[model samples]
Target: MGIKGLTKLIGDNAPRAINTNEIHSLFGRKIAIDASMCIYQLLVAVRVGADNLTNDEGEVTSHLNGLFYRTIRLLEIGIKPVYVFDGAPPTMKSGELTKRAEAKKAAEEAAKKAREEGDLEMAEKFSRRVNRVTPAMIDSCKRLVRAMGVPAVEAPCEAEAQCAELVKNGDLFATASEDMDSLTFGTSRLIRYLWAGTASTASKKGIKPTEFALDVVLQDLDLTLPQFIDLCILCGCDYVDGIKGVGVVKALNLIRKHGDLQKVVDTLKKEKSYTVPDPYPVEVLRQMFVEPIVTPAKDVVLKWKRPDVNAIKKLMIEENQFDSAKIENGIKRLLAAKQKTSQVRVDSFFKRATAPNEAERAAKRKAVAETNKKSKKSKTQKSSTSTKGRAAKAKKDVT
Candidate 1:
């Protein structure tokens, strides 16, 4: 669903762009999480015999349970997560949406058949495909996220795009999601495997979370942002069908050669080896990726407040039948975490550890001065391409 095969392709091709990061290393970081994506994963993961975890009222609580625990864990570790919920989907995604709906329906039928045949495993597998994030589920999650003192944004369109906008606007440090499409949306940093499972479980399973840097990717691939978008399209995105028979490597080669989607399409027409979709909607898809619809930066407000324990209790305990003692313990832990983080910020911690002493600084300055006295620096001396500058470019208007 997410620019199919793009994650593996990037890992294989752009090593500089990706790095394994310790969770504690991200202390005091603000990350924007794709709520819908997380909820879908949670629904799949926390299941009870092909059905979701539900309360006495027969309403699903898996999403809430997973989100509550995950968000708390992230916060306790000093990583402030901003949950971004998807609003309306893009019109360009109609084809993909329709296909998904059809697939879900088929899975439901198959699951029914399998259950009748007493193939529980097969039924469970197919039943997962039937899971969809409903509006009510999203609303409940947003409420829960807010109750936990996390900021929540209802993205105007795709949550990935909105998260990207936040990163560019300096509202967040990264986009946390399993989807590679976050790169296509222009998030400066994309975090993977953070929400794949519980931290202990992930550690035991050897699942290390990684952060992807887009600037390094662009620099390494020797492609402009537009060209990179074209490359992703070629690799197959939800918006448009990619050229038949063209793979990730071939797509990269084509984009590097032809320069853009239109040019690539033109070349494909001449070469019968690859089949392009009839009436290929290149311009529309390009527009969707290039200038995705997002809430205006001025209108967006992200504020992380103190966790309202009473509100959380009301939602999780009084309403959803979550154990009162467990909820109370979670609140205490969240408060303790907040207190600890408040006393020691990540920046201060890093500065204390890494900053040079007076003697060392003086020696470094003397060495630099002597080197500069004898050196003729080139104007073209390459500086490292970085994802860090995206923050300093933040406008004065937005809070």
Candidate 2:
């Protein structure tokens, strides 16, 4: 909200916005990913291209193919991605999921109805195209991810929120998610376009060469971490649907002046007779954004531990009928790359581990110090200018 220009750049080309050179700097970075989010994206892509993806056994291979290729790419890039999967849907989000399920059910029913009306081909196509996230499917994917040596965490609630909490606490350098709500959730680093390949180049203008620090954002918005949450609510985040007639620009302006949600709500209510709709219950939003379930802290071990080539080959080539030559080449290339660049030093991965809560507090203190310094300098300059202006006025009066 503080920078409309940056948001526009992101929208223009999310993948191309990130510079590859910057990625090298993050070679050893611990990236916490919302596993469900990534899997959902893959699922959608695969479902759309279902006709083209099949194994020798004539079984659909879209999910497995996407997982293998993407995981390989991430490992090749030297990113230590810890994937957090959703354990169970949050109580508040049940309505959203139920709504989706109802939509899918209606679609299926319509397809069936169409079949009865003699539209058999269309019905068959629609039946094959429905995307569902089942418990069994989630478990299967988790096993695959673990097999690939990516640490997988099962989050009790919102996976993205838990990942954000990890980033906030410095256990993770950034939370990789498409949602900008991570910023409001108080992640020190929220990286979009993480899996975009060359598409990250598009984010070059929006993001600085170095990671965009949370302190920089807070200063730019003239708000605290909590106030930033309020601003996001104003901008229509999930916790609270944004206020009517408030866009990004308007939301930023309101929050910068008021510095809190209640004040902003009161100001708008007085000015526009806006009976502020409670976006969600205040408690719910607070809990969702301010407090997230964090996994126990542990020392990060960053290494390009080789994949089990024999197992991968067995799964992809022997069972799935993947091109044996291609699988062999990919494995060979991965091993060679690992050998060429074996050691990586992650800045945040230290010998000692700190509790997630302690790390967050430390981050907050550092942010506050930087903010205070900036504010003090601004105040000093203003006061100095005021004194000079008064002295000049007195001299003019004496003359």
Candidate 1 stretches greater than 4 Å from native: 197-200, 341-399
Residue 275, model 2: Cα distance from true site in angstroms = 4.8
Each candidate structure's TM-score, on Cα atoms with residue i matched to residue i, is 0.84, 0.68
Candidate 2: worst 10 consecutive residues by lDDT?
1-10
lDDT of 2 by residue, 295-332 (tens): 43453333334567777777777877879888788777
Q: What TM-score number comes out for model 1?
A: 0.84
Tens digits of lDDT, candidate 1, 248-337: 998998887777889888888898677788768788888888899898657888887888888999999988999999889888888877
What is the lDDT for 24 in model 2? 53
